[model samples]
Target: MAYVITKLCLNCKDIACTQVCPVDCIYEYKGDDPSIPKEMLLIDPDECIDCNACVPECPWEAIFEESEVPDIFKDDIELNARIVGKERFVPKRNPDDPIPTPEQIAANKEKWGYKP
Candidate 1:
């Protein structure tokens, strides 16, 4: 199983996880959101080697093993896979890149607002 990035990362956009990721599985959307804030970070499960390198690397404590993740956040695993492509794990865009469309922000905001 792979690790997941949960809602705790929203508005925090910390990319420390990305810098520490050896496989570059961790990426931040950099376009609209520069500095790849926690809100923009999404782990590419496809590219992830399940190295656990990013778990401790996260300052916000957002990363967690798939099994260890809470039920509320477990869906993030599928979300990451779908967004990044289930078969091809490489990030569709740079983690430092941001696509701040209202839709993008709204989708993430919905999850962030619930904050389970």
Candidate 2:
């Protein structure tokens, strides 16, 4: 099964996942809905090799196997598949991407309703 990215990734565009993605399946998200919040990345469920390449790279702890996706982020499974083919998503990586600090990651998780 493919890996799913959850809301825990919101605003935490750490690209560490992108760097190690051997298949280059992860894409930058440009959706701006109120529910989407800040920028994040989406793994193209179609292109993903189920390699688990990105799971450890993400500092946000957002990526999970399709079956392991948290109940709160279950919708994200469909989201990743739906957005990968839409105009709002692209596989571009920025040269000056930000590396979030520990505190920022903790805050991001908290912002999305996770106590961690």
Best by lDDT: 2
lDDT score for candidate 1 against the true structure: 0.63
Candidate 1 lDDT by residue in tens digits, 18-111: 6677777766554442323335467777777888988876655678888888777777776555436322222332467443554554565466
Q: What is the lDDT of residue 90 in candidate 1?
A: 25
Give TM per candidate.
Answer: 0.62, 0.76
Q: Count of backbone clashes for each model?
A: 15, 0
Residue 46 error for model 1, in Å? Answer: 1.2
**Pairs with steric clashes in candidate 2:** none
Residue 88, candidate 1: Cα error in Å is 13
Clashes of 2: 0
